[model samples]
Target: MYIINFIVSIIAIIIGINIRRNKRNYLIIGYNKLDEKERQLYNEGKPLTTASNIFIISGILLIIGGILAMRSPVPNYLTIVSWGVFILFIFGGTLYINAEYR
Candidate 1:
């Protein structure tokens, strides 16, 4: 169970690093869908940096939560809460990027 969390965290961290390093707007989801003209309207650096930070931070939190779950007697609750917070972050981040960047 905790292994799954670790795997997901690692993946998220990889994605965050990729986005931060690549600095390619095409790597972003909704931003990618924007046509060239629309895409040009926004500054690239801020949104990519913000998104990358969000992913990296969330990934770290997932890893910490997983470790806590492993040592906790109530692993189930911890896992559930961890996943719930992750989901919230995902949605919130998406909304934030779309609203702020676009």
Candidate 2:
């Protein structure tokens, strides 16, 4: 699980860089669906890159937590809180991007 989480973290970081740079390949969060006008709006705003950063950070945290969980009996409270934050960030980022494009 830790290995998988680490791999995901790496992938997320790469995708985040792509998003920040506005590359079309391996685009995250349905960004490729944007039309010309929407693309302009996205470029004018920071939400797209913000969302990517959020995902990258979340993935990194998850990787760290997963590794810690391996050697010890991970505490329930910490796991729960981490998951909640992750979900909220992802949801908020998605909402921001969708609302912007819409």
Candidate 3:
């Protein structure tokens, strides 16, 4: 279970990295001409790229927690709860940002 959680955390980190990379690519690579609204959203999303940092940081913490759990036995329930908290935090932040910003 801990291994699975650790893998999930790694995936989360990868996702964050991908999003950050995509944002950079979008700016540097330059895409086809977008409508005004699309262009505005792209500009706005530039700021939102920082929002993905929440995922990256939380994922790192989860990875550390998983390692700790492995080295020094912790309660399984506690591990689950910790993982849930991070997931909830990421989801809630993403939703809030989307709702309020977009």
Among the numbered candidates, top lDDT falls to 1
C-alpha lDDT of residue 4 in model 1: 93
Worst lDDT 10-window in candidate 2: 23-32
Instruction: Compose the digit string of candidate 3's lDDT tens values, residues 22-94.
Output: 7642422223355667656655564446556766887887887677667665657657776887888787776
Best by TM-score: 1
51-81 per-residue lDDT for model 1 (tens digits): 8988888898899889999999999899988
Give the CA lDDT, 0 to 100, for residue 99 in model 3. 62
Residue 3 lDDT (model 2): 64
Question: Model 3, stretches more than 4 Å misplaced?
Answer: 24-42, 45-47, 71-73
Measured with C-alpha atoms, the lDDT of residue 102 in candidate 2 is: 52
Positional deviation of residue 71's Cα in model 3 after best superposition, in angstroms: 4.2
Cα lDDT of model 2 by residue, 1-88, tens digit: 5565567667777777666677442344565676777656555446656666776887877776666656667655555555566677
Please identify which of the two predictions, 2 or 3, would achieve the higher TM-score against the true structure: 3
- Residue 81 alpha-carbon offset, candidate 2, angstroms: 6.5
Q: Is candidate 2 or candidate 3 better by lDDT?
A: 3
TM-score sort, best first: 1, 3, 2
- Candidate order, lDDT descending: 1, 3, 2
TM for candidate 1 is 0.91
